[model samples]
Target: MEHADEVYDVIVVGAGIEGSSTAYNLAKFGKRTLLLEQFPLPHSRGSSHGQSRITRKAYGSRDFYTQMMAEAFAMTDELQKECGEQLFINCGCLVIGPRTADFLSKTKSCLKRYGIPHDQFDIYEQRKRFPALSFRDDFEFVLDKSGGLLRSDKILQAFQRQFVRYGGVLCDGEPMIDLYPGTIVSVKTTKGLHRARSVVLTLGPWAAKFLPRLGLNVPLQPLKITVCYWKEKHGGNFNIENFPTFTMNGAAGKHHIYGLPACEYPGLVKICLHHGPNIDPDNRDGVENDWVLDAMKLIIATHFPSLEKEPSIVETCIYTNTPDEDFVLDVHPTWKNIVIGAGFSGHGFKLAPVVGKVLGELATGQKPSYDLSHFKINRFFKTKL
Candidate 1:
């Protein structure tokens, strides 16, 4: 069906956290913006539908992200004030690992370099502080005071609402099927064609499907990750009040194992392995994987004796990873007006606000507020396309 072509100053595809954040920024800047989503609002098919996500400043030596987090946190605070809703909870976070692990020492050094308040807890101190957590004798813990949990689902909703309130147009259930890039980009979606002066592609796992059409091929792997929630055998042991968000790095051969304090599910805490099997995003639900579940059970039985060895509930989420696990935010080499944001890996949610702002600035031909050279797509251009 051909509908009337309505031109917009900017059109953002993939209305997840990144897309919504971009649209919100564009609209707030007084641009005639349009936001499009492939699925219905509040759907569980994508990565942003989760109830909670850990937000922290410690990035295991990634100081660039630590610098960007300052702005991201401030932006989130502004959004909370504007929406008049509680969007974040500062519950602190602990990174646990063996004393010899470089990640632990590097993270502690990074925190110290940034002057972020943190505490180092040896096995004895750890036991005294967080009795619910159990670890090996040689394990060391670093507490990040700035870390906490973000209400991810609510943040999406708040961004969309504030975007519309700022006069941005939102078109749900309209997936961009084709793009004709030129002086003015023509976006063809499932419902209709829309013309825009500039376009921002925050297409998440779907980036690999569309970027080829633009004559750019970046290595992006979409993995289906299992999110597990375990039941606490003793009530109040791992609840939100006392327990802090936690991560165990260099576990099970350098794979990250992380968890959040009990909040979403009563008497249940969220925990999962960070790495998963690569799979097609369309067939994410049917992918077979049991090793992660088995690993989580073993981890819980070994460390979290208070929690059940078996997960009470298991859900799925997708992660689009780059080789370096850093974000890809840059302008299209051929089409300067087109901005691309991809390969956030699994840690991009905490940086979405700054990412969106940078993407919007790129689309509008403005100087970005922060240094984005690290995130440029050129880093991956040397790879065989």
Candidate 2:
């Protein structure tokens, strides 16, 4: 027998979007799943809180992600029926960078492979198509027509609700104290000890802390990123109707810049850099991020003249990044039944549905749906630790 008190087939720790999505899939697959969360139902401490997130099939180097995004794009239609709410906004996502930039070329390769209706311009003459900002000849433009914005907070709520409807047990405000791995994985939480056939750790920023005690050393860095929204001088220039989601590579040296249309707030657009300083997830406040604001202002003054130089509203989010910025979607090195889904690295939100499916498959001892060589657990050698 697995365990006398094994009440669930799979236990998912961390009820963030990733964990919630995984629990939803497990419950839908008739797995008797249990989901645990440290915080309350909806909180802004983790990576899934922001109201708007850009959803696109564009990737820099990984075409498998583009394939996964295609699958993810299809799942949104299914999510609408389950949630009964608008989940996605259909505006193009534009990638702005140098023609010779590695990220742009790699992204172009994926776009070309799928024939996703993206156009690349050698000349800086995109004012007719998108007139919000000025373009430079040195920077290349890749217009991804499939790009849009996801109602992030609403999607998170929808996944959790669907998980509950599918017969998944969710316990919030209860943190996991410890986890034991075996044929029957047992998790000790703040309230009580729970046992299941498998455990999935989607701990977000808490991954670096908890993974080590499992005897697995993962290089997951918890970063504190500032999400800023700037106001457009014109009334509706950057709104969802007139604007497109955009990504600017090499904004401030190595870090990149990304933006979404004005949906969360009325006239403010969400444009921020993909960079932040390291921080402890438990203690997220009291960090200095003024330098990020300065860099963003410079970018706006140079490129986005329609928007105000200073941000109108500001917020913060966490990113559990790997050294390579790729997600860690494999199982535990020793315990195959215990799965680890961390290191989303800020860009994992759009792929949560597929990630959850993959984690569920791994938990139930089934073959993965897509190629996972890029997400292998041992990709980062122990020496790097």
Question: What C-alpha lDDT do the candidate models reach, one value each?
Answer: 0.90, 0.87
> Best by TM-score, which number?
1
Provide the lowest-lDDT 10-residue window in model 1.
1-10
Off by over 4 Å in 1: 1-5, 252-254, 383-385
Cα RMSD, each candidate: 2.1, 2.1
Location of the lowest summed lDDT over 10 successive residues in candidate 2:
121-130
What digit string (tens of lDDT, one per residue) describes model 1 on residues 1-385? Answer: 6334467899999999999999999999999999999987878887788889999997777789999999999999999999999999998888889999998999899888988899998999988888887877899999899999999999999999999999999999888889999888989988988899999999999997789889878889999899999998988988888888988885644568999988999999999999899988888877778888877887888788999888999999999999999999988888999999999999999999999899999999999998888888888776522
The deviation in Å at residue 285 for candidate 2 is 1.7
Kindly report which residue stretches of model 2 are placed more than 4 angstroms away from their true locations once superposed. Answer: 1-6, 122-124, 252-254, 382-385
lDDT score, residue 240, model 1? Answer: 82
